[model samples]
Target: MRLLFLAVLRPHTGNAVTAQRVRAHLEAAGHVCVLKDAFDFESPSEIANLILAENFEAALALHLYRGGRLLQGHRIPFGVIFGGTDVNEDANQRDKNTVMGRVLEEARFAVAFTESMKEMAHAQWPHAKGKIYVQSQGIATTPNAAFNWNTFLQRSEINQSADNLHIFLLICGLRQVKDPLYLVDAFSEWHQEEPNVYLVIVGPEVDPVFTREVKAKVKRSPGVRLIGEMPQEDLHAVVKNCFVVVNSSVSEGMSAAILEAMDLEVPVLARNIPGNAAVVKHEVTGLLFSNPQVLVLSAKRQNDRIAYSCLGA
Candidate 1:
């Protein structure tokens, strides 16, 4: 079987990881797999021509609305994988909902990263109930050896000797749906009360306007560190060294960052939303907070009680 996998690749992000995983899986199983970064194309017609040329047995699209439309227009037998924003946020919009609805209708099968996402899919598109499938996104293979803590801290500008400093690492591309600025306001208050506690925002700034806003907020908040984006290896190393990993997205499918933190045995402090709640089992792997106050309070409590070395927090 010749399979064509399509997605917007961010070099080393979740969508890229998913695309690579699918391609590797299919190829390892004796199928021909080709990966196409849809975002690189100038037009949909070009994408259609490329897919037609591939003579693919089947196609797998990462985002429902974007990738589905391209494959569907080409009359391809394709499957749609829901991204965090697709079900949690985009489906709420009138125009995006219509586009996503059509994609769901045309897909041979639709995949959700978590069981909660599977339920959301059914609720959103009841007519396509039979086609929805729940698939856990597998974590990347762990590094061969333990990460160097001192090297990672030095590169990320983290001070290891600051016993009072409670570092919360938030990793996500700069986008409106990610609510990247949520931590800015929260960090301001936390910074005033607990001078040593700092919130670090990491990830690429994909959206210009949103990136500008995030930069502006970062300038105002001394405690909030917006480190733009780091390489995948560096990002993973930083996640392993942070006091706790944070996710405050307004929407998510199943955050790859949250899962990576869990896999690395790092404690996650995420927003109390469906996508995040599904991964970070509250009080077990990490704590989920709906608002800034709750997050700050929880972080303080966790910091006081739990030793970072105990569970690699």
Candidate 2:
């Protein structure tokens, strides 16, 4: 079977990663998959032309509004995998919500990364409840041995020793929904007290206006630096070296960053949003913070624990 896979294929974005993974799985199962970026085409007819040209048997879209909107009016059967923003952000919009509802109504199947996400979709579009399936993405990490920590720190203009630095790596695309600046003030204040501590924000620049604001904020902020984007392979190594992984997004479906941190055995400090709370068990797998102050306090407490443990040994 030949399938057309549609997603927002922005570089270093989660939707692109998920689309590639799905394509790999379909191909492994002996199906041919044609992957395309939903943004490349303007209308349903444009998508129809591609589908007809490729002779695709089925279609798979990553986001309801961003990707699924294009899959509409096509004769071929299609499934939609919920993007984080679709449920967390766009569902609140009157026009977008209506379009999403229609998309789900016509979709042969749907996927949610977590049970809570599935429940949210069901509440919004109860008619498609049975067709909505929950499937957590499979994650695996392998850090490259050749990655040089000192070189990365130098290139990122971070002045600290690897042994003493308590680096918190916050990974997210530079967009408003991510709220990458949420903990900037708290982390900066904490840094004044603890000179060895640093908070690094790394990801692609998705919003130029927001990116400019973040860069300006980082310029004035101490111990907080925006590294923009790093290659995925190098990022895994950077994640491994960090003292803690952070997620300060205002909303999320299921953050690949949090999961990747857990998989890499790096401690995580995530915003206490429902999506994050679902994945992180407080004081167990990782810590969840309701606000910047809470996050700062939690990090301090965790650091104290580590200090005590080292002294005891």
Candidate 3:
């Protein structure tokens, strides 16, 4: 079957990564999938024309508002996959929420990355409850064999030995929802006490204006390095070597980075939002922090555990 899959295809972002993976899976199963960025087209008619032009048999959308809404009014059947903002940020806005409700009504099925995410969506649009299925995000990490750790540290201007360095890698697109600067002040203070520790943020400049703001603040903030986006494999390589992976997003449907870190057997430090809480089992899968101070305390605890382990060895 020929399928049209719509998603926000921003470089290095989760939705783009997921959309590509889904398309790959469908194609591997002998289905033809056309992956398109929802941002490229402005209206439903454009997608309708594309569907007719390409003879797409069925459709799939990443976000209810961005992709699903555009697929509305089209004759072809489509399924909706909830993006992070769909149930978290978008649902709170009246205009987008109204559009999402109609999209859910028209959708044949819907997918949520976690049971909690499904519940959230169900709470907002109870009419689509039965169709919403929970499927955790899948991750595949390939750490670059030749990725130079010392080189990365040097570039970040982190003056510390590779063996003694404790780098917390926070991966997120520079956007308001990510709240990338949430721990900037706390981390900077922590760095004064532990000079070997650094907080490194790596991702695409998603929101240009906000990215500039982040840059300005990070400039004044010591022990925090903001690197530009890296290729998927390179990013995975960084995650593989980092002391801990961090997520400070204001909201999330499901974070692929957290899953990837867990898969790599790396420690995770995430904001104690409902989305993170659903996946992180407190002291089990990862540590959850309710605020910046708690997050700093958690990091210190983890570091102490590492120190004890080294002494034991």
Candidate 4:
């Protein structure tokens, strides 16, 4: 099979990871894949022309609207992979909903990262119910546990302490849907009570306005550390050392970061959104919280338990 995979690429992000995974899977199965970054094209017509030029047997798109539109316009047998914002947040808008609905209608198959996401697509577009498929996003190669922690801490400015310090890592590109500042006020209050607890926000500032807001909030809250995006391998190594991984996104398809933490055997603390709930089994794989207080308390308890268990071993 000759496949064409399309997505808006970033330096280090989940969408990039998804596109890479699909390409890998197809290639490993003895199929040829032509991967293209949709954002690189100046216009959608360029993307359409590229797809037509490749004579692709099948097309796979990451976002429902942009990627879907390009491929669908070419009358290709394409698949739609819903991104976090598309089904959860973007679908709420009238124009986006219509675009997504049309994409879903024309798609040969619609892939979602989680079961909940599949359900959302079904409910959103009942006409395309039978086409939805759920596949767990693959994690890239796991990090070897041989990295120099001392050097990493020095480079990242991460304080290495096991006594009373609790670090919660939230990794996501700064965007409105991520709601990076949701826990800022709560983190400040918690920091006052437990000076040792720290929240680290790590990811590239994809949106300048949102990134500026996040930076402004970080300035006011000393407990929050805003480390912009790090390399994928480096981020995985950091996840291994952290006490707990955290996510507070307003919407998600399936949190690749949370899944990466689970794959690395690091516990997770995530928001109670459907995507997060699908990954974190609540007290099993990780903890989920609807309120800020619950998130803080559950995160602390889970972090302590994980730490004690590690020490005992």
Q: What is the C-alpha local distance difference test score of candidate 1? A: 0.78
Q: Each prediction's Cα lDDT score?
A: 0.78, 0.87, 0.88, 0.79
Compose the digit string of candidate 4's lDDT tens values, residues 1-313.
Answer: 8888888788666788788877888899999988888777666578677767877777888898767766656666788788877888888899989978987877899888888888888888999888888887877546756777678656655556635677778898898788889888898788777767878888998899888888998988867788878777778888888777889988887888887887777777789999889977766677778988888776556556764432232
Order of candidate numbers by lDDT, starting with the best = 3, 2, 4, 1
Q: Report the lDDT of model 2 for residue 84.
A: 84
For this target, which candidate reaches the highest lDDT against the unseen true structure?
Answer: 3
- In model 4, which residue pairs have backbone atoms overlapping below 3 Å? none
Q: What is the clash count for each candidate, in the order shown?
A: 2, 0, 0, 0
TM-score of candidate 1 on Cα atoms, chains taken together: 0.88
Error of 1 at 199 (Å): 1.0
Listed in order, each prediction's TM-score against the native is: 0.88, 0.95, 0.95, 0.90
Tell me the lDDT of candidate 3: 0.88
Cα lDDT tens digits, model 3, 1-313, are 9999999999878898899999999999999999999999999999989998999999999999999999998888999999978889889999999999999999999999888898889899999979999888877888899898778878889896634788888999999889999989999999988888889999899999999999999999989999998987888889888888889999988889999988888888889998899988777677888899998886677675742331232
Residue-level lDDT of model 1, residues 155-263, one tens digit each, is 6565667766677788988888788888788887887777677888888878888899889888888677878676677678777767788888888788889888878
